[model samples]
Target: MHELAIADSIVQIADRHANGRRVTKVQLKVGHLRQVVPSALAFSFELVAQGTSVEGAELEMEEVPVTGSCRGCGVESRLKEFPLQCRACGSDDLRVLEGEELFVESLEMEEV
Candidate 1:
């Protein structure tokens, strides 16, 4: 699964920042549009981090809901998956105000 690669990447970045410190947890802000399966990502994280500095590190994910603004109705609302139409007016002319992100928010680390 691609989540394995993604988890590996996260471990690499965390390892660089941890600098010999043990990682306790990693927080990620994931958007709905990112389409990442949280369970798969967590499983992959545990598998890839085995015997590493981050072994047993917890993977915490915060889901960001899809919010979009429709030009036709001037209304902002949650977006349904795919087709990306506005919920208020059913218009395709929608601009996303949030969602579509995948980034590390924080890393819990031991103090030396």
Candidate 2:
């Protein structure tokens, strides 16, 4: 699964930021549109972190919902389906504001 690669990348980033310190936790934000399985990511993190500073570190994920703004109605709403249409004006002209993000929010490190 691609989660393995994602997890590996996270570990690398954490390692760089940790500066040789032990990592205690890694907090991440995952958007709904990314369709990443949190459980799979956590599992992959454990596997990829073996023998590293990130090993046994807590992996916390915050899920973000898809949201969009309608140009016709000038209204912002949560999106539930594809073909992104405005809920208020039923206009196909919409701009996606969020829900395609995958990034590390913060990291906790132990003192050396």
Clashes of each: 0, 0
Estimate the lDDT of model 1.
0.88
- Candidate 2 deviant stretches above 4 angstroms: 80-83
TM for candidate 2 is: 0.88
Highest lDDT scorer: 2
lDDT (10s digit) by residue, model 1, range 37-109: 8999999999888878888999999999888899999899886478788877789898889898888899999
Candidate 2 structure quality by residue, lDDT tens digits, 35-83: 8888899999999898898889999999888898988889998986676
Tell me the TM-score of each prediction against the true structure. Answer: 0.88, 0.88
Instruction: Show where candidate 1 strays beyond 4 Å.
Output: none
lDDT of each: 0.88, 0.89
